[model samples]
Target: MHDHGSLPALGWSEFLTTWSLQPGWLLAVVILGAGYLTLRNAAGPASTVKGWRVASFLTGLGLMYVVVASAINGYAMALAWMHMVLHLTLIMVVPALLVLGHPLTVIAETGPRAERAMRSLPVTILVHPATGTLLYSLVIIGTHLSGFMDSMAQSTPLMVGEQVAYVVSGFLFLTGTIGEEKVRPDLPYLGRIALLVVGMVPDTIVGIVMLQTERDLYPVYSGARPEWALDAVRDIQTAGGLMWAGGDGGMMLLAIGLVIAVVSSPERRTKMTGRFLDGVRSARLAEESARGTTEGPAEPGSVDPDSDEALDAYNAMLARMNQQH
Candidate 1:
């Protein structure tokens, strides 16, 4: 057997070279540090710290794995195709699992006002139906049909832009799609299902690209396939097809779990739904309040006729769940 130690050290840009201070690795360290802080913060003396610890650790691993491929292959070598693959894991796979580690609920407990704001504004913009639909379509088409994927491995600047787009879009999709309670007041199980179905469109395209492409489009990496004598176009197409078919298929399965969550998670699910409704209430209230539609500040003790009893009940239910939990 060849002595593994005899292998000469490779430079940073040289494929399969010794590990070095590459940008992707540096990016990974930052991600790991952030997740570490997230877990560490959530683990404060009393709570079930195991969840955050595990979540943060896994998130770190997921990020590192994505970056590792880039680091070894050379950042900007192929305009960033590797980074796209990395993002597939970062935004889609990792966040879905990491949220279960408990940092999200801890974030919920950050008090009503702050939590409200964080989940509002920028967060709300993304969580909305229009934005989710837009993002899902873009993730599907932007990454594939638009020819953006090929350059991500070639240019660092474009790669950064791609990453920025992917992270923002993915995170928004996840939070709005997953732990939407803090942002939205009331989301039904079916509604979430609809959104996830939208999200899967991108993956479906990815798979189709792989399955349908007649010839390899990216010759660089596919040409370098380690052992497999795979055709470049066919290989790229297969990757897209796998992304389309398997990725979305996996997302659908995850959606099933989310359905269970909406059905079973009383504290988390109800409050989230209620809060979204509360936002609707607040918006309407602002509208009415602005137009002075109520005639006058009602006589002290006078009940307003427009007050919604269901809203009151929903609010009460949410309060009780919070206190009880």
Candidate 2:
């Protein structure tokens, strides 16, 4: 095990000042940040992409740097709760911000070839919401529930690998569910909301298991824990609680964001209303066609196909559903 014998007790001042200069991670961030800006600028006046996307993307990159290359990394190795904080930030908050950036949409705008490639079979499958959810579930459950944590603490490469996996899995999941990439099929807002809500289940499960487990789950922490670190059991419980709160809380916030986006977008609301009206019209036409085919002709007493009664009833049903009447 790497030495934590000389590690200082975590405090606000130290947390603020202590940072690991991981040149490799920093270089990656700089490159990605530069690339995103270049693409955003390249899209130019023709693009409708907003300014906030650029900000969100950069902010996400910054947070990723802090999580992996800051004092958090040091504390995380010796403290379970700190690790949970690092994990949740990497997997949840950072990914959500990046998704909001719409990087894929920006890339697709480069040319027809790029757009087509984005919509290619392999890319489509990789970004599918189901695939993302499955990978996310596996990562969360595998890393926390199994012996991966024990191994990760001792192996630098494994630690880096785990961090990379968290970001990738999260990015894939969010990119599929909440992303509005122009090259991909638009996921209905309601469907996006549902996916986010369901995704919280794995976090809840892992958190509860960690919080309630009777025995120490990760011996590695106990062995490497600094003098000031919480005892293993208490530390794990705290970590569990943090995971449960952070995971569900982050998902809920994102769901609410989707709800706000739907409510705020007049085009989306209009589209939904058009769909409802179209469904009603289709049903009416089918009913008329069926009556004509079966009875051969309409009787004098038959309801008029153009009558407003059906539309009125539908409106009333909607009002009732909304508790408006």
Q: Which model scores highest in TM-score?
A: 2
For model 2, give the 10-residue run with minimal summed lDDT. 297-306
lDDT tens digits, residue span 1-325, model 2 = 6667578888999898988888888998999999988888888887656899889999999999988888888778888898998899899889988988988888887778988988899999999889999999999999999999988878989989999899999999998777888777766676778889888999999999999977889987568888787888999999999999899999998888877877898656433334446466556544544442556533332433245754554555566669963
> Model 2 scores what on Cα lDDT?
0.82
lDDT of each: 0.55, 0.82
Per-prediction TM-score? 0.60, 0.86
Best by lDDT: 2
**lDDT at 175, model 2:** 87
Q: Which regions of candidate 1 fall more than 4 Å away from where they truly are?
A: 1-87, 98-113, 180-183, 219-229, 262-325
